[model samples]
Target: MPSQNEPAEPLAKGIIPTAKQQFHDLFVWKQRVVITNEYGETRTEWVTPEPLQNPISLFMQLSLKGWLYFLVGLAAWTADAFDFHALSIQTYKLADHFDTTKTNISTAITLTLLLRSVGAAIFGLLGDRFGRKWPMIANMLVLGLLQIATIYCATFSQFLAVRSLFGLFMGGVYGNAIAMALENCPVAARGLMSGILQQGYALGYVLAACANLGVGGETETWKTVFWIAAGISIGVGLVRVLFPESKQFRQKADVDESVHTVSAKMFLEEARLMLTREWKMSVYCIILMTWFNYYSHTSQDSYTTFMLTQKQMPNDAASRASILMKTGACVGGTIIGYLSQWVGRRRAIVVSALMSGFLIPAWILPRSERALSATGFFMQFFVQGAWGIVPIHLNELSPPAFRSVFPGVTYQLGNMISSPSAQIVNAVAESHFVTRGGERVEAYGPTMAVATAIIALGIMVTAALGPERRGSRFELARRAGDRVEVGKDVEDVVMDAEKPATVQREKMDEIEKK
Candidate 1:
């Protein structure tokens, strides 16, 4: 098999096609080029640079159904983020409510992280085997109920138990959402859409911050945030019910059912093949995700306390900074995600990581509240900007048969590995102190700054060596659909052209077998 970077096989006149060319014809992205030899003999060549769609017009080309599909995934993911962060943003109040240390409350967070992989494995297999629709709905409904349950927890153990179960259900949402959202998306539109989709996480964080601000950050009011998160999650489930299974999934199902029964055995075979083929890529993705989780948690999680305690800033000031940073994350994620379409995935991630590293000083060293807020904005901007590419990047790299399970499992495993980040930072920072306004507090600035810089460098290096599958087809049928859609003047013309040919081919194959 040709490597991802290798060009497509060169065509020759009156020559039978090579095996590589035959494979390329079915899958990889291709472009036409004109070449002239030294003897002035002109020939046409096909090259593959993972062509990009017209950025401005790309989204406009998505049908109404496509937009709806994308929105459902986004809403589900956003709700997932909202429910998770609802607890995170209110950790202080919860610590007080349970009469426990912050570290104990963090144990709940860790429990949630640890159990997410269990959810991913179970729900991911269900999603791949059955369909993405109902599993996703189930995941969200359970998550909402758990959020409500969280509101009624009278003890820390009860709270931790609810959160642990919540983590399991929460893990189910990500794989299914991205699978539902981007599976039918045009390859060209994926980068831009991926950026927007990943920001749903940051957007959820922003919503949680707003909810906290609205509720005045008191222990009693924290329950209200959970209530809101529950509502959002239920609403997500209801909205998803409006759509059918994704087009790519439906197509894949049609193909699978024709060949063999869809069963656990099929899933197992596919998983085995995928792991054997792309285990290295899977390992690399998990590592990248580990660094990413650490990057986000370390930079944001403890920084609020750092502001309120070490910098002697007001709670309002700290909240304002958090909101500003998340807003930057949303905007940056979208922009960098779109840029990745042209700049290439690994390059975009590396550049963003390096840039974020350079801003660490300004991000953490600022004494003034205003300056810190501004630096925090730009800091997360670059940090999450790089993160924006992840959804599509992972999807593009995933094996077609195992798309739902592969990305989710790796991401959750990474979350599990990075679960200790906040505690680690806290333990390290306890020994350092800073004095401001006659109050001496545990210093977090240096620790966060140094940790972020190191993580950023690690991300840059990891991404630089990772593969790029920018314009890979989402499913086999997509190739025919894309070809017809690309040059057509009318949107309806594509289905009309491809459907009969597909039917005829199926008919001929069946007749031949008979």
Candidate 2:
């Protein structure tokens, strides 16, 4: 340890931020600057940000290839969301078809959530070790087959079994999708792209609700939504076959070839080293994801049932309200995600969480279709607005070599921990009663309100205390002796070389003197 009179050494990479530092970072906008040493090696340092760039200009910075990668990743994620929400939104129909209680039907959801961690572990490692393309293609194709299998289930047990299998495949999509989507994105464009990308979930929900609306309220019509979901998943998989592996992955492979052949032993050694270094970050991310999973599932899964039972809305009205709700989510996620670039990620998340928490009373109190639709829209806007920052936030924090596994495993493990959220809500709502118009009803409104409030508070606190690495470089590769270099590809190094050299000599001189 340094003497009290001397300044302390800088914290190692991935060290947790102090509360004071976290608070400062919440409001600070650091500019990413490159510093080249005498030996012609470069590393990034964060200082005061320069003048803000136009959002349009930031978007224009992406090459055509970058846009294609982002779009394909978004499509895969949207299809995955559509497949999962198809079941959640149609829970009542499935229960009636199976001649089972709503809680029992929700068991399928619980099983699906519980098993997703396994898929994440398997596929995330596959994505990190192999190329992202084949693992994602396999995940999407298998998910489509599972969706069709779900439609053919003759028994509730079979339905549960199929959904469990579905969960396993579903867990793999998020890691690869976001990794491929944002890995090549310019630092300035990341927040905007991340926002747009995360909204694929809301868009999927909207599409599923629209399908449910079109097919009408008949018990058997849920099959049509499942079919549509299956088509979308299969279509995305087929489309992915046309694209080459992500440029970053290809570059990494080339660099690895020079150092040593890419093999299982090398991959495992890297993974073990990463875990030893980053276990704390991994644990923190998992906790954050657990709160987020609970926040979304508890507020959303049984909302249609809540409207039908407690608010006395018809199926069509409830479906419309749900569609409007997710539409708000799509809009909010995009807008807030964009604003996070300027306002800072954690501040954006904390503010959105608090705002959504405040809106809970209005969210649950509305009875009429128009009233409920309006409130639901605003509620989801803030709820998912906070969520909009998640994709890029996780990507920024991830270790460069294991981006796929780190985010995916943390997210799915969180999903595993919070798997029973919907079931818990259902059981509690059914067991407890609330009075509406002098009649008793399942207490979904109160249940959701209380749960959402607690979750919102949790998000605010967790995010406020967490560390951020908002513009860390991703175009990295390992050199000899496992030293990671900032630019791997020839083109990238050339680009950096062309930029003006304004090295922060004072900082370097100070470090040398110490």
Best-matching candidate per TM-score: 2
| Candidate 1 per-residue C-alpha lDDT over 287-355 given as tens digits, one digit per residue, 9 for 90 to 100 | 988998888888887877787667877766777888888999999999999888876777778889999
TM-score for each prediction? 0.83, 0.88
lDDT of 2 by residue, 74-141 (tens): 99999999999999999999999999999999999999999999999899898887768999999999
> What is the number of residue pairs that collide in model 1?
0
Q: What's model 2's lDDT at 165?
A: 91
Task: Give the per-residue Cα lDDT of candidate 1 at 191.
Answer: 85
lDDT of 1 at 23: 30
Model 1 RMSD in Å is 8.7
lDDT of each: 0.76, 0.83
